[model samples]
Target chain A: MSATNRQIRLAARPVGEVDPEDWEHCAGPVDEPGPGRFAGRTRAISLDPAMRGWLDDRPSYLPPVGIGEVMRAGSVIEVTASDHPDFQPGDHVVGTFGVQEYVVSDGRGAMKIDTSLAPPSTYLGALGMPGMTAYFGLLDVGALKDGETVVVSGAAGAVGTIAGQIAKAKGCRVVGIAGGPEKCAMLTDELGFDAAIDYRADDVRKALRRHAPDGIDVYFDNVGGDILDAALTRLAMHARVVVCGAISQYNNDTPVKGPSNYLSLLVRRARMEGFVVFDYADRYAQAARDIAAWIADGRIKVKEHIVQGSVDDFPETLQMLFRGENVGKLVLELV
Target chain B: MSATNRQIRLAARPVGEVDPEDWEHCAGPVDEPGPGRFAGRTRAISLDPAMRGWLDDRPSYLPPVGIGEVMRAGSVIEVTASDHPDFQPGDHVVGTFGVQEYVVSDGRGAMKIDTSLAPPSTYLGALGMPGMTAYFGLLDVGALKDGETVVVSGAAGAVGTIAGQIAKAKGCRVVGIAGGPEKCAMLTDELGFDAAIDYRADDVRKALRRHAPDGIDVYFDNVGGDILDAALTRLAMHARVVVCGAISQYNNDTPVKGPSNYLSLLVRRARMEGFVVFDYADRYAQAARDIAAWIADGRIKVKEHIVQGSVDDFPETLQMLFRGENVGKLVLELV
Candidate 1:
């Protein structure tokens, strides 16, 4: 066992946006597996915008992380030793294994990953939790239909990339909203989006009006706030607004302000439903299989933005998510 | 042809609540029906709270009543003569025949009624348009299920009365919100509700907590404003809030105030949907047949409040509604 292992821990509660001071680097000895526990080394750590919400103390679908705890993260790891019968040494496992190079697990939430079909990093992106989330959130919760116009915000992010692709595969006209020209270009050129609106420069409402002239049938909202209101104004009758994430408002110091024009629900007879992907854990394999099939057929493109860094870079990498710097799935490839 | 006929015309638009000055009595000669029409003597006129919305110039699901027009109403009339193949002399018909002593129609929007089931007034009450509204709104839009807890506002009104009875017949435990002790007593005793809350005297939230201690499954809201918010707070997971009519807020001079606690929809994973009864016109006959079967089998009881008056008494009879003096269905029987 290694005498020294380094991990990033939450040093303080972040205010507004996360700062480097919010984390503390610690070194400790890697532990061997007990009777039921297994140990692994983290290969890639996922950086999701939802992590910002987990850092704040508030009422959400999940509880916030306590101070001094290993910062919460989803990771692709290789088991070096195992005691559990369901797993073995040299098996690639994926789970919420925290911000560390080495992790020991009881195999409670870990899942064996196939490195042949894609790679360890793809498990942290297109064929993993975010992909399954986009699939279920769009298809099951949104109840998307063929030829329906889909408007997705945070369109360059992990879930958004897969969501836009899945909608396109379902015979839908997809509109992507992202931050920069390059991201918007990637959405249109690479991700098969019909239209891409740079939320940084364009008026969202005007862009939505122009791109989705028939009005939005399903608005997959990852960036909430003004974008949500803009989408609400352009909803067709019986439209469904899927609240997958609210990256824009998650880091606010004050009380989260909701959209004011929500009466559009009554005016348009539309519905807005919020769901957590964790709710569909048992059905994730179904989403993964379908997504993999689509990828195999060249109907869905996989995009993962991998950053090479040490475990100590976890705090800074998470900050990149809130700043809208990373395109597609943002993940830290551990050295 | 009857030369003597009297009608009530809209005199002035009410700024808030309808007052006596808002109505005008006008006399007109009763015209004879043409080759494809029927002449009916107006026996009873239904007074519904929704009639207030028709007076406004704003856009609604239905067109607003034009200035200086006959006040719109659902009428139970006895056919005196007919050239229409579907209607015959001495046949009782229900139509949107306005507030008048006589009406002539070319068989359009008219349905023949059988007086053998109940009395002529009950058609304007328990088995009429309000009854159909309650039936379809509760069953189809609300998606009510057996043994669910149903909380309805305006519990002593025509539609509310039948809605509670129908829910009871479907094995739902019903709670009603009314204005006074007498109305509440009738809702519990005569209407067979599980409990009744008098909103005028009692606190709505506390009453709901006491009556529906397990949380509400379906909320049939007829009176909006604070009552809607109160019900929204008590909704269990996946609860359906049916927006039938907002009687309490109909009198507001400014824009109707929306409920501030609507974030509850997100919290409960519930839905709040608004529907106009006219949307279900194609399925009214189907709803009527099912509702009639229940009434015939003694599963549901009919309640009617009849007020006998001359055509000139229309103005005064309408005031009885705003005063909350009538129970069940408030029908003005032209005597």
Candidate 2:
């Protein structure tokens, strides 16, 4: 085991796009598990669009990461030492373990994972927060019905891919909207999406009208902006717009652009609802079992873009999400 | 009865505000009731903000008023002649009778109203479509709970007055937003709203925060411009925004200013839903009963700005609604 741990701490509150100077990389003495605690080495860290929201000094589902504090993150860690009763040495756990090489926890909000079922990275990707987010955001908040047509924005991202697949598994026709032709092709060709719209190449509203000719019954929004407005214009009667995240607007210096065509909700008798995944913590195990079953049956495919790096690479890897550089679940795997 | 029926027809679709040139004042021969039909003399016409949306050629809850057609309006009429089974002379009825001095109907959408309980103009205001809109939009779409904090925009207008009072009747703390001080004062003093914000005089966001310090549980949005944005910022967790109308943006030549702070919905885990009151057609009777009981018990107050004029006055009276010139319900009563 390493005698020292490397960590990334927030140095400044970003104005718009997060800058390198905003993060401070430093080394510190590794924490030892005291009474009723366990220590672990982080194997993988999740890079999410929601991370951008946490960097701002504002109120949200979770409190902002304060300056001089380790950046808040969801990661998979392997236990190295333990004074806690439940956790043992070598057990893999998933939790909000922050952007660090080592962690000490009291088992509050930490869950032990079976590495034999899937790798540690898979837990951070398919069986972790993103998976639970797509599960409840679509099925619960979205109130999705079988055979309904669904349109997913940021379709190549973590939650979007899972949301689209869950819709397909329920016998619904799914259309994906992603930034590039390659991402669009991956959505349709590999992920079982009924159709894909390269937002960079197509007039999204017109494309949506053609692909979802009957109008989208459920729009799982991850990239909010003109794409959300496009989805609003093509909603069927009583459509459900699931407000999951707004990756496109996360780095904006100005205000988040609201959907101008949102009044279409009135004309179509539709609704737009926002939800946080943590609210469904009690049902995470059930959602995981269902997701696991789908993966085993070949109905759901796990997609992860693993970048091998140290904790210092987190700031750049996170920027990739806003720039739409990575596909599916973007993760940092420490060597 | 007069030898000719005076009518106001749509001349051209207005680009921004409806101009005098957009209306055609003409006279037509009064038609007799045909087989299985009825004829009536228009008693009072309801002026609504929704009329502007009907003038625009777009897909909406209802069809646009075609050029050269009688401008669509909801009015109360006194039955003068009938050939149908359910019709009789001297019975008062309400329906979408258009901006005309006389109306011929097959009794399709007509409802017989009791003038003994309320005046004919009151039927066009408090006991009519506006009343039902407030009832269903607040109780159903808003999912309002007793003792909750409720904020209403356009609170001195027809629907707003009723909505505010209904919220007050439910034992909720009601805050109203209107254009001028008089309208704001009317909301608090006469209509039973707990507080009022004059958007023209005060900083709306600051007023909302001060009035609804704990956060707004239900926001019944009737004017969806900056006021809607202001309400969005003050939402409590699990808030419901009922998009009843956007009178502020109805006549804008430019695109509607979308609520820039709408992402507050995500941060607060709230929802914004839109509904057409016509969808609750089957439940209007029940809703009207509740509203009527409240009014009778003095828990609700009826306010109307009645303009006594002929059919030629319809154009000017309708404009009073857009200018925020009238308080409570604005109605043109035919002499």
Candidate 3:
């Protein structure tokens, strides 16, 4: 076990796109598992677009990460020491453990995972927060019906990939919108998407009209902007627009561009709803089971973009999400 | 009855605001009621913000008014002659009978109204389409709960007045937003809104924060634009934004200004939904009963801006709605 731990702390609030100056890399004494607690070494850290929202001094589902604090993150860690009865040495756990080499938890929000079922990185990606987010946001908030046509923005990303696949599993026709032709091809060729629109190459509104001639019944939005406006113009009657995340607008210095064509909701009698995944904490186990079954049956494919690096790479690695440089779930795997 | 029926027809589609040149004032021979049909003299016409949408060539809840056609309008008419068994000469009926001195109908979409309970103009205001719009849009689409904080835009207009009063009748704290001080005052003093914000005089966001300090549970949006954006910033968790109309953007030559702060919906876990009141047709009678009782018990006050004029006045009277010149319901009553 390492005698010291490396950590990345928030140095300052970012104005627009995050800068290296905003993060401070430092060393700290590794925490010991005190009474009723367990200590673990982080194996993988999740890089999510939603993390950008936590950097600003504003109100959100979760409080902003304060300056001089270890940045908040979801990670999978392997237990090295324990003073708790439920947790033992070598047990893998998933929790909001911050951007650090190690973690000490009292089992408040930590869940032990079976590494034999899937690797630790999978827990941080397909079997973890992103998985639960796609499940609930697409099924519950979206109110998706079988055989309905679905259009998902940021389809090459974490939640979008899972959401699109879930819709396919439910017998729906799914169309994906991503930045590049390679990502678009991966969506249709590998992920079972019926069609894919390279937003960089196609007029999205015209492409949507051609791909979804009947109109989009459910639009799982991960990247909001003109793509959202495009999806709005093609909504079927009583369509559901699930507000997942806005990766495209996360790094903007100006205000997030609202959907100009949102009034189409009135003409089509549709609705747009937003939600946080933590709200469905009670049902996570059931959703995990369902997702596991889909993966086993070959209906769902796990996609991860793993970057082998130290804790110092987190700030730079996170920028890749906003730039659309990574495909599927972006993760940092410590060697 | 006059041998010539005076009519207003759509001349050319207006680019921005409807100009005088967009209307054609003409006279036509009054047609007799055919088999199983009825004819009536137009008594009062309802001037609505939705009329502007009908002038634009776009897909909407209803089709646009074609050129050279009698401009479509909702009005109350007194039956002068009938070949239909359900109608009588002295009975008063309401329907989309267009902007004309006389109307010939097959009795389709026509509802017999009781003038003994209310005046003919009142049927075009408080007991008509606008009234039903408020009833369904607020209670159904808004999912309003008793004692909740409700914010309504365009609160002195037809639907706004009824919506504010209905929220007040349900024991909710209602904040109204209107253009001028008089309209704002009328909302609080006469219509029973708890507070009022004059958008023209006060900073709307600040006013909303002061009035709905705990956050707005339901926002019934009649005017979408900056006011909608302001309401969005003050939403409580699980808030419902009922998209009823966008009178503020109806006549804009530029694209409708989207609510820039709409991502507040995600932070607050809220929803914005739109509906056409016609979808709730089966429940109109029940809602009308509730609204009528509230009015009778003095929990609701009816305010009308009646312009006594001939069919030639239709074009000018509609401008009052867009200019925010009239309070409560704006109606053109034929002499």
Candidate 4:
């Protein structure tokens, strides 16, 4: 079986905003499935802030993507060719398949998605990596308990939306901090959040004080900047600040804005910890099952901000995250 | 018994250095032992940096010492009179008996000390609160393991000296930071520390880099500020910074200089935690036994910087800590 694949490769590392010249579109013929590998047609791609970190050459959790390698991404693909024992052709699969029209993998870190339950992009968003990040970050790392108040920044983004829902399901009073009124309304109305702070209009610290009268027990910080400083002020005793992502300072020309009010941790006996989704790999099965059950019960809302585009449009699609233009999850549907 | 008891009372809170005007000496009649009470004559008073935190009118783990109350101090006292069956007249005891020549207590939070094994002064200095703070802070809070590198600030002081010894005893490489060359020499030569960084004479970060090239696994910080900043830059993965005290910033008229490099906690997956000694009250028996055993075997050296003075000299005794004039555990022996 011959499959033509259109791939987006990193031409150069971006300076600030990723320029169009930074990515090059390359087309090639996809080969037959190897002894253990399978070939699939790509459907939707996931855009994440960690994608920016993977581009910079520094000692981080992961190495930088090489210039010649296909731009790293998590995507949903339709399985068309398979020779491995675990899978068959026509099965819907999801994994880190890069920015390509077709993907061939050796069944490592790949999950079979039943679109009959949720859409293909949903597996790439709410039920996948970002979902797992929010789950473990708030519940395990943050040590969230019932009746505790949770305040999540980037409340309308992929991780924040899922985190709020998970905390709400766990019987927590959840408050969300989002940029616009629309996103704020979406957090409170669409998701089961107790309160939403419009950070664009209201003062973050004052909003936190009003919403969390007893102070926040858990702070799920995705956009770390002045907002993180604002949250630091209202942390209660034994509060946990989960550092899932720092979107606010990822593209900073200078150093990231260090939280000046960190002494609050000492005063409140609080803790701030960071986590990567890879650590939760062994427990994903249980988490995915729980999330799927929650979705089936209409307890969690799945929001996918899908952009219909070709492989060359990958760089532009990623910019949507930095600009805060995408709602729930930003996905590039290969055309 | 008509004992002429001299008690140091807090006259006023000081703005910077504690002055004689801040304290008032009262010559009062010795409190007689009532039913189920014991009257003890103070032998040695434990002068600790934590005594400063008790003077502040802010909320902490314990209630602040009131304006006209006797200054709180841990003391080794010999019971001169007893109406309680649990304690005898000749029994040596360790308890928070205030800065006074005589004390009367109902035997709560008071542990009987045996002078047959060690000196009564050792109960207030080494085998006492400072020793317990060092043991628990280094082992429990710091989670120290064998073969790891331990860096301690205020290395010549009571808690620091014991912490360094305990880390060394656990088969760890220990580095200490002290004010002068003499204290540095005492730390390495006398206290069994692997290396000593004289903060007054050498660059602390440079010394740490040279000594603990693999990065510090645990840092017990007593003298916070730039020393804490230096230690922050050298933390290994999952490093624990035990906030035993911050004496360096205690008497500052200005706000404490916070360590700006604290984000190293995130980069290294480290933590900084504060705890009051009272939190481990139930485990003091375990600590005293272990520390006394270590001292007996010469695994830990017991050093007491005893200042022979009356209760009226309490203000001047407290100032020695801020001035860094005393080494090991500073205690006031009533003369």
Model 3 residue runs over 4 Å out of place are none
The residue pairs that clash in candidate 1, if any, are: none
Candidate 4: RMSD over Cα atoms? 4.2
Per-residue alpha-carbon lDDT of model 4 for A30-118, expressed as tens digits?
Answer: 86788998888888899998898788776666779989789899999888888888878988999999999888899998988899988
Query: Which whole-number lDDT from 0 to 100 does residue A190 have in model 2?
Result: 97
Docking class of 4: incorrect
Task: Residues B1-335, candidate 1: write the lDDT tens digits.
Answer: 53677998888888898877888888899888889999989999888988888888865656787768899989989998788999998999998999889889987888888999777887777777888889987998899999999999988888898899999999999999999999999888877899999999999999999999988989998887789888977888778888788887777886555664554565566776666677788988888887789889877777777889877787677767767788888888888
- What is the per-residue lDDT of model 4 for residues B1-335, given as tens digits with 9 covering 90 to 100? 66688999888887666768878888888889999999989988888888887777765667888888999988989999899888998999988899999999999989898899887778876788788889888998888999999999999999989999989889999999999999999998998999999999999999899999999999999977888888988888788888777887777677666665555665676777765666788898898888878887898998789899888778888889888999898988887
Error of 3 at B122 (Å): 1.5
Which lDDT tens digits does candidate 3 get at residues B285-326? 897788788889998788999999999999888998898999
lDDT of 2 at B141: 95
Over A1-335, each residue of candidate 1 has an lDDT whose tens digit, in order, gives 64677898899999998888899999978989889888889999998888887887765556898899998999989998988887799999999999988999999889999899888889989988889889988998899999999999999999999999999999999999999999999999988899999988999999999999988999998987778878878888778888787788878776454654454565566777766777789998888999999999999888888899999888877878888989888999988
lDDT of 4 at B262: 56
Model 2 lDDT per residue over B1-335, tens place: 55799999999999999999999999998999999999999999999999999999998999999999999999999999999889899889999999999999999999999999999878887788899999999999999999999999999999999999999999999999998888887887777788999999999999998999999999999999889998999999999999999999999999888888888888889999999989999998898888889889999899999999999999989889989999989999988
- How would you class the docking of model 2? high
Q: Across all candidates, what is each one's fraction of true contacts kept?
A: 0.11, 0.72, 0.72, 0.10
TM-score of 1: 0.82
Proportion of the native interface contacts kept in model 2: 0.72
In model 4, what lDDT does residue B265 have? Answer: 68
Best by DockQ: 3
lDDT of each: 0.85, 0.93, 0.93, 0.85
